[model samples]
Target: MSRRTFSVVVLDSLLSLATKLQSGPMPEPRVRTAGATRGRLWRILMVAGVLAALGGAALVVTVLIRTPEGSAGRPETAAGLPGPPIPPAGTDAVEPSAVPTTRPVPTLTLPSSVATSASSRPPTTSPSAGRGSSTPESAVVPLTARYTTSSVTAGLLGYHLDVTITNPAPRAHTDWRLVVTLPRSTLSVSGVSGATATQDGAAWTFTPDDTTSRVAPRASVTVSFNVNGATLLNAAPTDCQIDNTPCTT
Candidate 1:
């Protein structure tokens, strides 16, 4: 108990006490402050969780409102439903098939005389008519003319005729003549050339041209003449001659 020593001893005791206090349990004020801070943090976390849940609910409601009610019956979008099949190349789209129909045909017949004559005769020539009269020129040699008449016109008396000259010889003929006699009063000549004409009573004579008178063998030339007669005269001649030779008479 000296004064300085006593004071020093008391100071040491105070220091030990402060150290003990620091190492001991927390003070009431600090613990309360910490509790208050923890409470505030917990409240903030709960509020954030609630807000997130509300936002999720709002999104679900929007989706439900946007979806169409009728879409349920149609094919599903996300289920990967298949589309209509495509048609094969060059083929038409599938459709119902159709039925078919059918039909028939016809025929013809000919006369017996024509059939028999046609069959018996040679294809190119006429049959001999009688005995021994040296086969007529047509039977001796086959002669043909392309046409018997040259020029034709439609008229009141129908049509007129001309003479056709045919050269049945193998060589070309330089001279040709045709003499046609008809009743002069019954007919009138509208045009004539390179011909000599004369009349004897009702009959007239026509002498053919000698200048341009040339025809090739197996070929023919036509000379026209005017005629006045029946309307049926417009028909073409069935018999024709080659040179002086008659193919058919």
Candidate 2:
């Protein structure tokens, strides 16, 4: 061989040696590198998915916990969301079943002395209010009688005198009579009101008529008579008596 060709062949051998040293080993295939890259991408995606799933679970738990705080014992909606909170029942809004109802009771008030005052009413009066002649006689009731000349008028004979008899007793007299003494020659009997008159000599007895049978406690009765003689003009009645008792003139 020539020297230059030997040198060129040696130099080419050195370049090949250097190239082999720089390359070291053979590079992997594109299919293997692509497969490895796909495996790394798959692993990263799985980790991200797991983290997202954990975050979703945490959010769900938070929602459940918060939901119970806002609306305790409330049912969930169709969308898995919590419903609105329910307010406590107020006093005015309480149901009839929750509270018992009672009827109002009536109260009665009476005076303190009602029993005593009722027992102290006035006593009832007796059934027989007045004393009658037929009544079983009791003690004589205190009484007084008076005679008065009510009126005097001149007449053909002489004068006529109207006399009134009054009873001052506090009780009634059912039967009454009056006796009067006068000059028979001067006075003559005439029509009498509310009584009957019977004369015998100078004494005259007057008995009560139907209307004057009962003399009220504080009442008066009248009797009238005429005088035939003129001697009665200045003369006065002699004496008057009632119930056998002397009477005042």
C-alpha TM-scores of all predictions: 0.29, 0.39
Q: Give candidate 2 regions above 4 Å deviation.
A: 1-138, 150-156, 232-234
Q: lDDT winner among the candidates? A: 2
* Model 1, span 1-249: residue lDDT tens: 544433345445555655565467543333445787776676567556655655665565566556644665666454777766889899989776776555555666679998898899976865676644453444433334342333354555545565555666555666443434333345545455445556554444445467435566667666555555553453343333444554332
**Predicted structure 1, TM vs. truth:** 0.29
- Which lDDT value does model 2 have at 193? 75
Judge candidate 2 at residue 25 and give its lDDT.
52
For each candidate, what is the lDDT?
0.53, 0.64
Worst 10 residues of 2 by lDDT: 148-157
Clashing pairs in 1: 166-243
